[model samples]
Target: MSMTVARRPHRLLTMAPAVLALGALFVIPAAPAVQKGDDFLTPETTGVLNLEPGECFTDPEYSPAAGEDIVLYTTCDQHADNQSYGFVHADDGPYDRVALADFGWTSCKRGFVNYWPGAAGAELDYYPILPTAETWADGDRDIMCVVYDPRGELGGSMLPRAS
Candidate 1:
């Protein structure tokens, strides 16, 4: 006996709309959270000083005015890994790297993204950029810092008023 396979006919009426809908859903673009002079900052990125929900954040450097505390609005949380919890520099080139020195934590790590959480506002526990501490320490003092909280954004975004 020969096995006769029936071919399924193509149905555009039912399939086209479904395909289009799926495409549209997947193709929907989310607005970029971080931009120059923009309030939002990303946790994944370390160089940016501004914090934004759905974005990484950083604090500006305390230079020339070293030892002089920079007013920082940071997220609050205690992570198991010290590296994960504390602030970090974004990149090299002048703002080579650094984190706050005298450290403290607030109650909140997860802040409002579009919600723009209130900064715990602490004196940055800062340190200088050195090659030795790479493995142990985060990095050089960057004008950039981040607000890390796993609850919502994992990191906090800068408030509009912070700008």
Candidate 2:
């Protein structure tokens, strides 16, 4: 799939071409060896489709020349730029960028409300990391809904706390 990652502008509702590339200053190494009985081991770089709900990560950085995207997983308690809230699968159909984006936007919006019911009045915003034509052709149909605090880094997960 060429390792390209597409992202919409943070907090924007308009539909635009999904050709923007996220850039990072440094590259992280591959996944570390896991210890016995460990619950989870986050990889240094991963596609958006691999992120699970409530997992925190830095925004992915991509270089068009390199045709690669790098997403660094981080602990929710630490400072991070985004968090996976939910995922939506695109319906079976021909590859239409607009159609896919429309479906993703609508679905992810509903997911955002469901994931964080109290976010309507907050400064938090959500964006979707969608599949490109290359990725779609390779059977990638998942859209990841990610939430972030527009003001700065998120100190914790956006998932609602238990009562």
Q: Which lDDT tens digits does candidate 2 get at residues 38-94?
A: 112112235444568889887657757657766667888787878888878888678
**Candidate 2 accuracy as lDDT:** 0.67
- Return the top candidate by lDDT: 2
Candidate RMSDs in order: 15.4, 22.3
Supply candidate 1's per-residue lDDT for 81.
9
The whole-model lDDT of each prediction reads 0.31, 0.67
Which tens-of-lDDT digit does each residue in 1-163 have in candidate 1?
9999997767876699889988998885755332222123222223333333223223344545455323233343311100122333333333212232211111123322223334322311211122223422444333232332222232222233434
What's the lDDT for residue 162 in model 1?
A: 39
Highest TM-score scorer:
2
